[model samples]
Target chain A: MAEVKTVQECASMVADGASVMVGGFLGVGAPLQMIDQLVANGTKELTLISVVGSYPGGGFDIGKLTAGKQVKKFIGAHIGTDPALVSGYNTGEIDVEFNPMGTFIERIRAAGAGLGAVVTPVGIGTEVEENASKQSFYGKDYLVFPPLGADFAIIKAKKADHYGNLCYDGTSMNTNTTMATAGKVVIAEVDEIVEVGTLAPNEIGTPGIFVDYIVKGFSTDERKAIFGEIWQKGNKLK
Target chain B: MNSREIIARRIAQEFNDGEVVNLGFGMPTMAANYIPNGINVILQTENGGLRFGGAPKAGEQNPDLGNAGGEPITMLPGGSAFDLAFSFCIIRGGHVDATVLGALEVDQNGNIANWKIPGKFVPGMGGGMDLLVGAKKVVAALAHTDKAGNSKVLKSCTLPLSAAGVVKRIITDKAVFNVSSKGLELIEIAPGLTEADVKAATEADYQVATNVKTMTF
Candidate 1:
């Protein structure tokens, strides 16, 4: 039996200092409502892994958390978009490990698949080597990036069946599908929930077994408003 | 011609026949229009699909099948999707022949600093770092000056770099330059443009090639 709850309930499961994997690229496909609930809950000293930076800045969920100093460490591909994260990093308020985007995604996928480690040539002779281990195989150099799994994986999806099976629309499937199996507890927030077997088998992106809980909520329209603010700020720049 | 079209045509000339190429966002995206007729160059996009054609007609765009820049694109025959692992396997595995990218700045040591500025917030670095290391050759298409009319070709970047010493050549509206161990060597200048005119627009000291000629359209 799958238990459905609210975003607040999902946030309650996250304790202070928990390691979490968040799904999305920039603002797309992020579990905005759940992130908001976490921010409101005021859980501090967290380790966050995401592809994008904090949030869109001016009151976005990720940005607010970063600004509130809830996060202690961050591992991801880029932080250029989030002013709070960048400022925090530069000011030594937070620790950051920057992974290449593709490599970051692969590390999460490798964790989900229960792989110990994966080898790639992306970070060879680059700053990515600062944290990653390098090894040679068959006379070729490769960087060994460890698989990343979190205590909780929070993600957004388009729809879900009563069984907790998930479906994502279009490119929204980006990182959520892989993150489902990369965490000890997978919490999903969906816009719509249907009866069991309602979703076509072929449309199921993540099986119910990988998902631990489902949260029902509407993502706030804050992102569009934030974009407007950013655009306004950009227009004023010389 | 507009700056976009000029940079696009210049990048198209850099391609050899039957080469596999990846075009990063901005001016490099325009190269799809200028690929010579009968050339079988395959365009690999980091967003999962490969063999993308020219821009899609209005109402025919599928957001899921778009390029890295989120622009509507047409898929050529035999296009497919693989996970990020396999997509980069083609990249870091050295299957791509060349990659053309847009840059914010290029320094004397061939370093690119396109990912960020000190105070301004921009999207984080995408596949530029991976492509720079994976592709056999790197070509940058950009304007010679910043929007504030400052020179972007510099002795060294003040901003954080996306790739270190990987730029092979740069195709800009004012001139063409190749990065050598000895620093930036000017290979060509736009027709009717003088060496002094070009030098005043750039911050770096440039070595003029003896065989300078107008870039063929």
Candidate 2:
């Protein structure tokens, strides 16, 4: 059985300058309480990897890390949503590495699946091909992207079994399930923890064998309030 | 109709009944609202939801449900969600029937540049390259000219390419075109406009289709 841990304990596991893969598309399925704990812990010089910069209009979710100057670098697919990230990129405060969304996730999948690299024709004739090495099979050209793994992966899930198997709600399973396999240490944050048998085999979005620790996250009401507050703060509600 | 709505409606006609279409964010997303009646077009967002419903009816938002653009939405009856890898399988594996996206520039050869403007706007190309390459038919929906009144359909795009020679059709407020081996073909012009107007507005070289007609919808 996976030992249940505290948010503070999980936050302390992430060292300064550590590479952390956070699972979320903007704010959806983000480990919000864990992110807040990281900020409150004053962790700095971190490499933040995810799918997008943050929520649109910014100043919430991962955007808070950029605001606190905690993220030294950002590796993801989109940066246009968060003004904090864009401003940091322009001022030379944060280094940004851009990748196509699918390719980005595929590289992470490669890492988790124990593959050496990923080759695809996705970036064939664009500037995305500039950084990757090109290889040819027959007559078609494909770009080779190396696997990307992180020191720790913070994943959010709707429910978890005592053994750390996770069940996701809706589209919340963006990069969480994939990042779970790629991280050296994977910590799952969940709203509720159930007995191992409670989560059916089909309900297990991410298997427990890959998960190291489990932490309790905010309840549905708390998460709802947080989203409302963030959107209001970002003027999406106001 | 306004330019954006007109462009959206025109592009909406490109999708036929029982077709799955991926709608990119911003202007291209507007095409969903204008989809022609009785045409059952399925909308897919690469962030991992498909067949999205209108905004939540109760106005109670669920934190987990949203589209690629980060806008809150609901899945329609028979809608489904999947993991990121599976989502991209539907995207990068040529399962998407058609994909509609806004183009920053469309060159004479049907190439598009929509991801970056270098220092000004550098949103990472999010699933655009895969969509263009994997979709059976790729549609470029945008205004005929830019905000500063420069032609967006140009001789060649100065910006970096999102995907090479992938655009199958171009829909704009002023005209509709089909990309072919010989380059852009003007198939429909806006009502009250003539070939001269399209030629004046477009910087790229094009051929006039013999069956050209005025846009009705």
Candidate 3:
């Protein structure tokens, strides 16, 4: 029973201090229309949970929000691609909580699956071990990472049904599938929305039950235009 | 030959056939080009690609298929794409046979520090920590000294450590060292470089092997 809404209408549901999970690796998979709406709404003091920062160079994708100083804190694995974020962190304008890439997603997956914690050796004997609790199982030490859930998850997908079943294409599926379930209010932005029973069962990356709302985002042609715009802007530096 | 290329060529000799390997950014990425033609090694990009070919030409680039560094690459004959979860599972589940990475500092105890530098505002630890702790064999490729002529090989790391006591082999412009229970052991020195030059440049105490040879590749 997922509702279809405009990006502005869905973005209005977010409060000033809400914790948000933005799915994408840099810019490719970001829900740009929804993100633009959030920026236009002037949402402030948000806690952002993402896998990586915006694409290299600023003034596009999540870099727009970061440049606007809307995010108060960022929780992610890598933020190197965004200079604004680095400047924010250096100036104490933004607080950053860094996690190893695997542990970050695993924690989100743990929240989605209702699991207690993630125990693995990915961060053992390193700086990441400082915050984790150590336990010995199977004669090896593992750092236990806690689950990470958010107030909202803004995700991008290739297609979806009216029932909100999602299907992703190519690398865009990186973090969107897991973040869809880890948020209390999941908003999926897709290129096209079909009727119920349109998407086959095996093709769906995330089931409809996990999606609370669906918003029509940029079509493929529009996406290509936007990419061209951004790429051209980046090429000016070269 | 440039120092980076020489180091990359030297480390490329370590790859065994039928092994799954991951190369980190910077110097380690160069090893992909030097991998022997018939080695049959599979390259894994942490951004969710495996069995991928080397970097693609400018016009041949596919936007959807790129490495973790966002460089365009080609998919080999047996290449496959999985999500980030499956890619990391391959890393953390001990399926990656060897991982070559860059290092900022390495110590006699074989501890590595590469991800962060205090007051420098680094983006975040992307995959270095996980790769260091998870891979079956960890090989570090780096310059022997920092830009300021400071020794990068030290008695103990001064910067934040990425992982502790995990490095097994190190190939630098000056020489190659092996980490053992006894600490850093110099097994090979670069051509025209003597054991004394290595000792003078290195801050960490290391044992010179009884029969050290000049680097070949």
Best by DockQ: 2
Model 2 regions more than 4 Å off: A228-238
Query: Residues A1-238, candidate 2, lDDT per residue (tens digit)?
Result: 5789999999999999999999999889899889999999999999999889888877778988998899999999888888999999999899999888889999999999989998888988999888799999889999999999999999999998888899998899999999999999999999999887888899899999889999999987787677666554544431
In order, the B-chain TM-scores come to 0.91, 0.96, 0.95
Off by over 4 Å in 1: A54-58, A219-238, B1-9, B12-22, B29-90, B93-97, B104-124, B142-161, B164-166, B178-187, B194-212
- Which scores greater on TM-score, model 1 or model 3? 3
Task: Give candidate 3 regions above 4 Å deviation.
Answer: A228-238, B54-63
Q: What's the DockQ for every one of the candidates? A: 0.24, 0.63, 0.44
Minimum summed lDDT over a 10-residue window in model 2 chain A is located at A229-238
State the displacement of the C-alpha of residue A206, model 3, in Å, after optimal TM-score superposition. Answer: 1.7
DockQ score for model 1, please?
0.24
How good is the docking of model 1, by CAPRI class? acceptable
Rank by TM-score, descending? 2, 3, 1
Residue-wise lDDT of candidate 1 within B127-167, one digit each (tens)? Answer: 77888878999887789898887988999877777777888
* Among all candidates shown, the one with the greatest TM-score: 2
Residue pairs that clash (backbone atoms under 3 angstroms), model 3: none
lDDT of 2 by residue, B1-217 (tens): 7888888778878888989889887677777877778999888879887888865533366778777867667788999998788898899898899999999899879899999897788878878888988899999987899888899998899998999999999988899999987999999999888899999899999999999999988
